[model samples]
Target: MIRYINIKNIFIIYLVALIIMVVLKGDLSDVLARMESIIEQRNEGNWNISLKPFESISSVLDSYNRFGVNIVTVKVAILNIIGFLPMGFLLPLLKKNNTSFIKTMLKCLVFILIIEIIQFIACIGVADVDDVILNLSGCIIGYIFYLIVRPVIKS
Candidate 1:
């Protein structure tokens, strides 16, 4: 129905906007300038990609133990999880085949992997396996949420 489509479109827009925010998390006014800077960094070999899952987390823990400063790490971890939670739930709703749990999760992992790779190559952000873990966890949480809410909405 038209009504369903309108709502679905609105949700799609919101999901896309949220994903952009989750990835960029920065000023958009000078996107070209920012991208140029990133490109420059890439050329200059300012490359930073991390495969170690707990390296940042360990440093954060160390910082917390030494200086009682955790705002940066804690906030980032929480935000990463929170940001992807909606993706988990929304993807299932948006994709017909994604209703299956394992299929949806595998798809989410692939999607997140691609995003992380782009961030690394583009110099937009650090590529971290820890983030993948946390983001995947968030998506699973979202799937749980969808499972809880779907029946209620249908009935």
Candidate 2:
């Protein structure tokens, strides 16, 4: 028989693969633990900072005691950025060709919010408002990149 591949079906496979990777990496537990530790830090009065850029975004960890963005917030935001940006990349493949960028961004934001809620209830991590914002920023950045790169690739 001739080979046939539906792009949507391939995207579903990719999503399943991503979910499996997340589960196998024990990332869920790690995320939970990180959140819990952050909440504990907050309770201990360890949540305050100043506005200064360190070597990397995480370099602020060296001076967390004096910085506004604590380690947990940074970590969670970074995770959201990493996780959701790739997830957004898949949307253009799975979604209708005419889907608007704004709608895609909103869908990514909603997905991040669900993850944030799960993180809060998992008892391993702190549910943070800032994490959602940063994560959405990352998704928007990824979507914009897609917009810029698509025309080039199609040429």
* Best-fitting candidate, scored by TM-score: 1
TM-score of each: 0.78, 0.56
Q: Deviation in angstroms for 29 in model 1?
A: 7.5
| Ten contiguous residues minimizing lDDT sum, candidate 2 | 48-57
What stretches of model 1 exceed 4 Å from their correct place? 2-7, 28-46, 95-98
Ten contiguous residues with the weakest lDDT in model 1? 26-35
Error of 2 at 115 (Å): 0.6
Tens digits of per-residue lDDT, candidate 1, 64-109, equal: 8998967888898888789888778877776555488898899889
Which regions of candidate 2 deviate over 4 angstroms?
A: 1-77
Q: What is the lDDT of candidate 2?
A: 0.59
lDDT by residue for model 2 over 54-73, one digit each (tens)?
Answer: 23344545556576658675
